[model samples]
Every structure is written in C-alpha cells, then in structure tokens.
Target: MQPAVTERDLNQADVADAARYLAGRIVPTPMLGCPELDELAGTRLLLKAENLQHSGSYKMRGATVAVGRLAAAGQATGVVCQSTGNHAAAVAQAARRHGLAAVVVLPPDAAPAKVARAAAAGACVLRADGDPHEVVRQVHADTGYPVIDAYDHPDVVAGQGTAALELIEAAEAAGTPLDALVVPVGGGGGAAGAVLAATGRGIDVYGVEPYGCDSLARSLAAGHRVPVTPAATLADGLRPACVGALPFRVLRDSGIDAVGVGDDAIAHAFRLIVTHLKLVVEPSGAAALAGALRVAETSTHRTVGVLLTGGNVEADLVGRLMEGSAA
Candidate 1:
C-alpha cells in the first residue's frame, strides 16, 4: 500500500490575490495558437511562451514576485535561494533588478552554463555536494538570510499563479474555452499555482513530471507528499525529490491531475519544438507539451493550454539534446 501524500491546494481567491500582487512585475508572455499542434493532438493548443520570459524561463515570474514582495516590505537583508539551475539565474536576475544582493546555493553537479549564468547575474554561487536536500539545508543554516524557497513559499506559489492567469486571459482573447492546462512540475510551485489559479475558471489543470522523478505524481497517489528517490533523467529542472507541502496541499484540495512521462518522449518533444516551432526548450519545459500532446491524442478536450515554462538551455547542450534530430 502507498503512504499518505501531502496536500498543497490553494483556493481561487488566494490565487487571484497572488496574481494581483504580481501584476506589473512579470510580463504576460504570449500564448501562441498552434494549428499543427492541435491537429496532432486532436485539440486546440495554446502554447504559453514563458520560454520567452526575462530569464528565458518561468522561474523569473516567481522570483520576481518573491523578491519584489520582499523589497516592497522594505526587507534589506538581501535574498538567497537553492536551485537546480534555472531558479538560481532567475533569483539572481530578479535580485539585480531590485538592487538586492543575491546568493545562489547550487548542487555541485549543476550545469556549468547555469553556474556561469548565475555568476554573470552577480550572484555568489556556492557549490555543494551529495544531494540537493542536504546542500539547501546547509545554505539556510549558514546564511540566516531568509531563503526564497523555490517552490515552497506561499508568495512563490502566488507569483507562479500569474502565469496561468495570463494564459487564461490569452485563451479568452482567442475566444476559446480551455478544457485543460498542462505545466511542468519541479517542486510543484508552478503546477500548484496553476491548479490554484484554474479553479472556478472552468479549466482542468494537470502537472507533468519526468517518469524517474515523479514527486508530485507519487505524492498525489499517496494522498500526501512522498519523497521520491532520485533517478537519472534529462529533465533536470523537474527532478525534485519531494513535493513541497504547499504544493501538495494545493494539489490535494485542487482536484488537479498529475502525469508522468518518459525521458525519450521529453527529448522528442524538445527536438520537435526546435524543429517545428523554432523554439529552444529544455527537457523539463518539453514535459508539458508531451503531456499536452498525449492528452490531446487521448482525451476529448477541445482546447488545451501548454505552458512552455522555460527556455534556459545552454547553447552547447542544445546540440547534444537534438543530436540526431533536425534543427
């Protein structure tokens, strides 16, 4: 029998308030309507181009919101966060914009490009060994600075909800009712926020995770949060060990679904975005499209919104990721 899972559900009112808080900080990335994707998936597809966000990823939305809120509160102690990679850059960029000192705690194995990018953004990068869990804890213990948690903070969840709010607006502008929305779940900030924002908006929200790193999926099945044993997967951005408490609460109460996909499918979708859409997508970013395509192929949704959560892949990694496929 599976163990109990944590719940991370938020109500529509809370999501709306969060969106209001993030109104001007994060841009409303365009949602491109794709006829071809719809044709292939058997449903209208709205691609939320968060890949075009300021940090080339959706992490910026949460970072900007989180940092901005702190700044608004006149917190002068500066900001720090632990990340796989993207969140580091996002936090650094956001901190820079707010004139705040930034420190990034990164796993030792974090991509070199990610390290360079965070450093370029004026963040102090501290590399740690063993698991991400241990590293993040140590960073928090050492730095007494309030850690801007990547996925666990309520403000971060609220900020991430802004993405889904924008997507819903875009879909409404296109005069279509969205039946479902798909997002790549890492620590479940974006997925939890998306689910929270979609409530009463008449859209079903689904979180997609890499097969080997199905934290949210496992948590949902367990009816509480479950720590996932890390496995090798190319979707580094979504390889979280456990679903955050807030995200689990939101997922449990929000009635959202979780989908787990394989690495090969994510790679194929990554290549497809480059070849067909001329968009650079990281493996984790492609997970939503993979889920969207799968859902469109199998479900009866008339329209599905796929959030392209990030595009911060290193230039060299792109070649390796799309090696055998056409560019």
Candidate 2:
C-alpha cells in the first residue's frame, strides 16, 4: 500500500466574499471568443485573457485580497513573499496600495523585467543565496513580518477563484455554458480555487502543467503533497517543485483533473496565441490553452475555458522564444 501523505487543505468559507471584494477592485479581464483557438483545440474555447490583469497576471486577484484582508484587520505592518517574478510584483503593488512595506525574496536569476516592476512598486527585493523556503524562514526571523505565501494561503486561493467566477458569469451571460475549465498549475492555488468555483456549477476543472514540473499530477497520485526535482522549462510561472498543501487538498477533495504538456507543445501554443489569438501571453500563461488542445484531441470536453494567466515576459526573452531559439 502507498504511504499516507501529509498536508493541510483550506476550505475557505469566505471564498464568495473574497470574490465580491475583488469584483469591486479589479478590471474584469475579458473572456475572448477566439474561433482560431477553437479550431486549434477542435472545441469551443473561451480564453480568459488574464494577461491583461493587474500586475500582468492572475496573481493580482490573490494579492489584493491577501493585503486587503490584513489592512482590513488593522494588521498591515508588512508582508513578505518569494516568487519567480509575477507574484512578487503582485504582492509589491498590492502592498503599496495598502500602505504596507513589502519584501520580495527571489533567486538571483529571476526575470529582469518582473524584478524591475517589483522594485518600481517599492518592494525591497532580496536575492537570497539559499532556496526560497530558507529565504522566507530567515526573512520571518529577522523582520517578524507576516508572510503571504503566493498560492498556499486560503485568502490567496479564494482570490484566485475570482477568475473562474468571472469566466462562469461571462460565459453564462453570453448564452454559452462551459463544460470544462482549464488553467496552468504551479503551486495549485488557482486550480484549487477554480475547483471550488466550478464544483457545483457542473463544470469540470482541469489544471495543466509543464511536463517536467508535473507536481500536482504526482501529488494526486501519491495521495499527498510530493516534492519533485524540476527540469528547465519555459513555463517558469508554473514550475514549482511541489503543489501547495492547501491547493493539493482542494484539488484532491474536489477531484479536479490535472494534465501535462510538453515544452514543444507549449512553444507551439505560445506562438499560436500570438499569431492567431493575437494575445501576448507568456509560456506559463499559455499552458492551459495548450493543455486544452490536447484534451480536445482526445477527450469529450467540447467547450473548455482556458485562463491565460500572465504576459510579463522580458523583451529579449520574448523575442528569443518567438524566434524558437530559446533554450
């Protein structure tokens, strides 16, 4: 028998309230009807263009709620987090708006454009020598600041659900009911929140990750959160080695499906999105669309909603990726 896994799940009772709070703040990114994508997927695909979202990713949704929750509680002394890029910028921007100090710990090799954005937003950017987990530990020790985990906290997970909420409402209002919802998975918060949102709506929720970073797939199979050694992948935003415990719990309890797409497929989808959908999305953001194409090719899900999560690629990187020369 397989060994039992260990982790905590967040059944956020206030997820609906989180959605309402975010609705009042953010620009509702569009659910674009792209027939070109539909043909590529061989299904009706409604692309939620979250690349246009604040902070250039869906991270803003959770960032707003997390920082706002602290501010509302009168405890907004400061917040710290670790990220590859987009989440750091989101937290920094949200912290600035709430009049709180923000510290973003990232690897020295973090994306230049995203790092610049976070710095511009007034976050004290730290390039830690150790792993992000260690950096977070030391940050807490020195600053005693509250840590806002990118996708592990319930507030953040609930905030991520707003995209799904918006997608559902927009699809319904347009007289098109969705059958499945697909998005990229990293820490799994967005996908977990999506499961929470799509559960009773009779919509199947799916999370797509880069093949080399298929943490959620392995975790679900193991019946617990399992760590992995990640390989180089273009989907940097979705390259976490382990699924967050909270997100793992939500996905396991809710029975949402997870899939993986190869780097080649992701590259193909990235270019297709630019040329056909005319949307500028980074590789991680394009993961869902790529996964949906795979699903449409083999599955019975006819109408799938794909969340394009971010577009904050550096200029040189984008050019190299588009030229198909990026390693």
Candidate 3:
C-alpha cells in the first residue's frame, strides 16, 4: 500500500491549483466592508461573503473539488460524507453538478433547513445518532462508494483553502492586505486551509469555536489532539467533538491560535451582520466576527479578514435571534 498522507504532503500550491480549477465553477464571493463593524471592533474588517456561495457556504469549494476529482476518475457511482449541515448540502450539490449520486450522513440533530437542502439536491440523506464518522464508514462499506471526509481529506483541505486564497488576493488587490485571518472551526478543515493559504504571507491565522465546544483550543493548549463533548451553543456547525487529525497537525505546526466565543456574543454579531452588512449570516459564520472582536482587544491587527462560513440556519432560530430572545 502507498504511504499514508499527512498534513505535510499538502501545501499552498495545492490550494492555488484548486482555486484555478474552480475558477469559473464556483462563485468568487465578494469581500465586504462594514464601517459600523469596523468602528465597533476598532479595526478594519474584511468579511468574505461566503454565506452567499453556492450550496450556501464555503463548504462548496471543497466539495466541488473533491467530487470533481471523483467524477474525473470516472469510477465513483456516488460519493459519501458526514456533516452537521453545510458540508452535506455542498457535497450533495456538487455530486449533482457532476452527475453522480451522493449519500450524506448527518447527525440526528442537524438543522432542518440543511437536511432539506441536501435532500433537495438529490442526495440520499441518512441520520445517525452515533458517531458520524463510523456511520460514514459503514455507508461506504455497504455501498462500495468512495468517502470524502469533511476535513481530513487532502483534496477537501486544499479546496477549502481556496476561499482564504480568494480573500487574501482580494485584500491585496484593494491595497489592504490582511494582518489576521479568522475562521470558525468545526472539524478544522477550513482553519487548516486558512493556515496553508496564508503561509509565508505574514498573516496570523485563528480558529474560532463556541465556548465549551472548543476542541481546537484545548487541543492546541494540550500540545496534542484533545476531544470534548460539545456544549449547547447556537453555532451548531462548530460543535465537532475534535479537530481532524490532518488539521491538528497543520494547526500545531503553524502555531495558529484558537478563540472561544459565547452564544450571546455570537448572537450579537449575527444581529450586527444582519443589521449593518445586510447579510443573514448563521451563528456559526457570525462566530468568526465575534472571535475577531476578541482578537482585536489585545492584538494590533489593523485589518482582519473573517470567513463568513455559511448561512443555512433554521427559520425559527433566525427569528428568535433577530428578536434577541434566543438563548
């Protein structure tokens, strides 16, 4: 068998190549600026509007690349993956675009909108109460289909990095290069991708998590991979029990920092984004801005870039959050 791939095997070039391959296939989401948010944070904030991306999240970037590769090989009858929400929808949509079937395993508590979106995209959606990874493995074993891990796969990581690469390039084109990049962490694919995209660019990368759901922070602090039973938080997408092994290696080697944000802060950021930016960012996406505000408290990052990861929140939750009554 071939030697197992590690984080070291992936690099910035892979991200650049992914970006090139995805040039016309995906949306080149806008880099938005909000004076109100900048004033509140006491620093300029460059928001990557990935919430408007295809499949309604940045997850589309990685899913497209992964699915396209399988389609190109002309062997996969279908693709399989497990996710809280966004990745499932993205994979389903990508598979549809490539004319391949998709099987997505989601947690029992996955958001209804996300589940509906995945199903609408023609994916066979399955809900499992146990570990999603194990369920994905079983699905692949039963169907003899290739599995595209949400975060661990090299192609996924490289594809996800394209979002950050686009943000970095957009900032430079506007003559305001990013000093810091903040992304809300789930399984850590996007954060690891940010690390790769911003490498050698003098950019400080940070991974954000909901308070008490901070597996990445704990893992970083412990100098090893650590798992946590995620706490109750509105940012459901960030509730992964632990960072992916590949992402942990990339983050640990890059010395990237992690931040923890509470629900209240995330809600506040959500309201602010909706009010000023006129963008309906989900709590998971808003958490990046919350973490950026915290980072700005002590850091000298004048211009920070935040990835608005997704916008697939439930209607009831959105209403509750907008009414300022969400717990």
Output the number of the TM-score-best candidate: 3
Q: Each prediction's Cα lDDT score?
A: 0.80, 0.84, 0.91
- The reply for model 3, stretches above 4 Å from the true place, is 1-8
2 against 3, candidate with superior TM-score: 3
Full candidate order by TM-score, most accurate first: 3, 2, 1
Q: Mind giving the per-residue lDDT tens digits that candidate 3 earns over 1-327?
A: 112234357878888888888999999999999998999999999999999999899999999988888888798999999999899999999999989999999998999999999999999999988988898899899988899899898888888999999999999999999999999999999999999999999999999999999989989889999999999999989999989988888888897889989999999999999999999988999999999999999899989999999999888888999999785
Q: What's the ranking of the predictions by lDDT, best on top?
A: 3, 2, 1
Q: Compute the lDDT of residue 153 as modeled in candidate 1.
A: 79
Candidate 1 per-residue lDDT over residues 158-201, each given as its tens digit: 77887887888778887986889999988988988888778777
Encode model 2's per-residue lDDT on 1-327: one tens digit a residue.
Answer: 111112434443355667778876887899998777777677899889999998899999989988887887785588999988998999999999989999999877788878998999999999976689788878888888888898777788888888887898789899898989998999998998888778678888889988879889898888989888877888888888799977887888677878889888888888888888788888899788889888888788767888999988877767776898667
Model 1 CA deviation exceeding 4 Å by range: 1-10, 131-138, 325-327
Determine which window of 10 residues in candidate 2 has minimal summed lDDT.
Answer: 1-10
Give lDDT for model 1: 0.80
